[model samples]
Target chain A: MTRNAPPPADSGAVRSAGSSGSGSSGAGRPGFLWAVPAAVFFGLFAIVPLIMVAVLSFASWDGLSDPEFTGLDNWRTLLDDPVMIKSLWLSVLLTVLGVAVQTPLSILLGVWAAGHQRNRAVLSAIYFVPLLLSIAAVSVLWRAVLDPNLGVPAHATWLFGDGNLFGTQATAIGVLVFVSTWQFTPLHTLIYQGAARAVPPVLYQAAQIDGAGRVRQFFHITLPQLRNSIITSVILMVVGGLTTFDTVLILTQGGPGSDTTISAYYMYQKAFKSFDYGAASAIALLLVLVSTVISLIVVRLSGYDKMRSTMEGL
Target chain B: MRKSRPNHLAGFGSLVWLLVVGLPLYVMLVATFQSRPDYAANGPLAFPEHFTLDNYVNDLNSGFAQYFLNTVIVTVCVVGIVVLLVPPLAYTIVRSRGRATTTVFRLFLLGLAIPSQAVIVPMFFVISEAGLYDNLIGVILPTAAFAMPVCALILTGVMRDITPDLYEAMTVDGASPRRVFFQLVLPLSRSGVSTIVVFSALQAWNGFLFPLVLTQSVETKVITLGLYDFQTERGVDTPGLLAAVVLSMLPILIVYLFARRALVQGLMGVGGK
Candidate 1:
């Protein structure tokens, strides 16, 4: 993974002096012009809209009208909006729950799949099927599979008990978290599988020689060795969970009320549904802030930022 | 050096997980092949009394074919844009010493943090403002943009592995940047290019929120949006709905079967996206 690769040694200073002409020592190096097209395109769609989100958060606009600067009104409304508060809470709760549920499960499954056994290979292949499905497809499939009257719940009454799973807040949120877990665990398992395979067999061998049990070896050696992958997987889960929109839309529509309306969905509702673009922008900004802070913390902790120069080493 | 103890606990757990994973899939497949009346009568877990292809036939006739085409167009265009732009940009990031190139790389790093959902409000405005609203171009542009950061990161990683000695040899032979790019860089980064192709294609194919918000007409609707509308419009038609769900994944499943390694590597790279 790029995250663990050493920062590329800075050879730019030595090469830049001769980079002025095509036939210079740096003649083989592509110039900054090569990056301009992608940068401009990304800036237009991503960066420019990000700036517009910030500006619009402070302004009032419907999809039809011109945005008018309203000072702090949108921000003030969001601060007071109970649903906004609840949505933030729900986002956090779901994200944390996703990480908690998926981490250990994926870690175990990943390490298990890392084994070279043929059955492990077959089982892992089956395990990976869910990852191939889109969120919409998965949510739609689960919705049918778990339908209260016509689906699994109808037949498995002993387990589902009326099967109005999406009718209540707790069950609705549970469905969201579970569907996300079911859909995403395989990807994380793949990550951990790769990481686990890369763990030195010597470490596990030494631990075995010391009479460490399988569980003990997993705890002391495997767990520690998987630290970086854990961080990478957790970060992906956090971001994916935070911006979880499709599953919510397909499965519950954040519903039975605003019960499952996490921030992302709520923002969607505010802008597109209610046409409150200003308020939606505010929520969008908040989502960005939260994700950015979380990403920065993880990147800093994992020294991912240091890997930014990975290209320089080439 | 290995313990010979059969791990009953893990075996049990794995079987349980297999059931959890496999059961729904079985239900989906069975439902897709059964008529609605047959499905409702048999329940999701039941074996089909009479297998039929009507559900799939009905879904395809009901505009799923168009949705699939739209999705393919979006996927191909997104992949094309990513392929055309990203390699050169990644090449620049890997080989250039210019300060501006470094800035460009960092910009993509920041791009990683900007989820499409976050800027969607303004994205709606921007697309509409550009007169691309409700057009496939509207969906295509932003989807490609969002796919770029991850594609750039992956390709750059692949390019960086080209060993400086290889570039030095090419340079000593009086190869220009273009010559080396074609002869050495492009060929060596084949895996990375394929990975990005798979990555960006998946993004465009599976994209929902962008199409959900941007395009409304059936003509522009992608498969994901088509499925969403299918679920919302006819939620009770389990067989038809599941068939559409199955259809939505069929292309990727085909890709997965033929290029499992590349597809898996591509999905793992999506951790960044």
Candidate 2:
């Protein structure tokens, strides 16, 4: 696992950013001649389509005719659209709530699971089930589960109430949030567990000897030690929340009255359903802008570049 | 040796949390096994007294199997192609420090940021032009490409991790860069490769938007798209839809169970702090 292996001679000095005494005796041409096909494929498929998206974002189209140049009208409409506005707000709300709810729960589960190594494998396997399923499938499953009349929630209502629970907006959002957290908790738990595993056992021993109670030791030792993983998970949750489309589409299709609509879902409806490609592109551009700004801020605030280098170092 | 109050509290909390977490899944499983009348009569949270496999049987008979195969084919092919393509690009980017490398990386990132939903119209034209309009490869190609940016970014991160020492060492020993890449970089980057495979496969298997717009025939239909079609066709065969969902999710569930470690490792790479 160590990157500190013995360095070869010829091109060895070229890599002397770290390893010592491995002189460049066999120096020849710089190596990198076999990267052609992959480069071409990535360029044609990934790189080109992105350029197309940016260019088309400004073009006015009715889906059949050649795209017409309509300047910032699309952009202007994006700013003025109420549906877009509401959905964006909803996406932000969901992200905030999702992070707030999932983080502590994941930490608790991870800490508990990590401590009892005996059942760790079995527990981790069971926990990761939701991550593997398609978002659409999860939605479908939950929809049936939350069916007020014939669904699972109706059955569970004997405990809470024998009323229509799924029809209410707050309850619906709560269910969505709960479902989202269920899928995402396993991811965060894995992250926290990974970090916790990396914490040296001697530190915990030291804490125990210092009369640190379990809760006290967790806050003082585990939480502080897992700062990077916590930041990573939160950022991921935020990005995922912002870009969410599939589950919402399958579960509610923007809901009984657009209550569950998110920005991405709204845009999809605009472009495809309404044939408002221009408006859709404009909305998508704005989404990209928001996500980019948020991502950059996250990268900076989380010290992501430095952490990436450090993680690589490890 | 100390008080047991905290332990009791922790145990109680764990049980409550487990129930909170497990309830939805519990409901789904039970509902899937219940008779339609029984499902309608009883609330979802209750367990089914009679375990009926009829829902599953109906789903399997109702083209769910075909959808499952299509999804598997598309996901496997997309993952295969991406795995074949991304590593060498990453190696070149890491090994060759120049404008070209920087430009390529930036290009991939641009693709990453530009949501594909924006350009579905042009993409459809392009797909048609290539005579792949209704083909799974049409979906597969774009899906694989869309995934490239993130994959390349991740692979670049991983490739960067493969201490330059190994490649340099290989070169000093008179091995060609190709040999070094195949022998050293690929072998060293096994985890990253697995990460890419798992991520790409999930994306392809789970993708809906592209397939929904691009393909028209049932033959080219993936599970997500197929489920949509089934829902549209049947309106609301609730038990059958749930069954299709359970079937569709089987592969991912198995993969996640076995490779949770790698998936976590991969998540760290993509969701890197």
Per-model lDDT: 0.86, 0.71
Query: Which DockQ-derived CAPRI band holds candidate 2?
Result: acceptable
Candidate 2, A84-164: lDDT as tens digits:
788888889988999999999998887776765455566566777787777777777777666656665454556647645
Off by over 4 Å in 1: A1-25, A301-314, B270-273
In angstroms, how far off is A44's CA in candidate 1?
1.0
DockQ for each numbered candidate: 0.60, 0.41
**What would the per-residue lDDT of candidate 1 be over residues A1-314, giving only the tens digit for each residue?**
21221122234542562365345346567666667788999999999999999999999999777789999999999989999999999999999999999999999999888888888899999899988788888998999888988988788879878888988988888888899989899999998898889999899888878989999999999999888888889988998899999888888988988888999999999988899999999999988988888777765775544653553443
TM-score of every model versus the real structure:
0.94, 0.86
lDDT of 1: 0.86
Tell how far residue A269 is off in model 1, in angstroms.
0.8
lDDT of candidate model 2 versus the reference: 0.71
Candidate 2 chain A — worst ten consecutive residues by lDDT sum? A1-10
What RMSD does each model have against the real structure?
4.5, 5.2
Q: Which stretches of candidate 2 lie over 4 Å from their true place?
A: A1-33, A158-166, A200-206, A297-314, B1-6, B42-50, B109-125, B157-165, B232-235
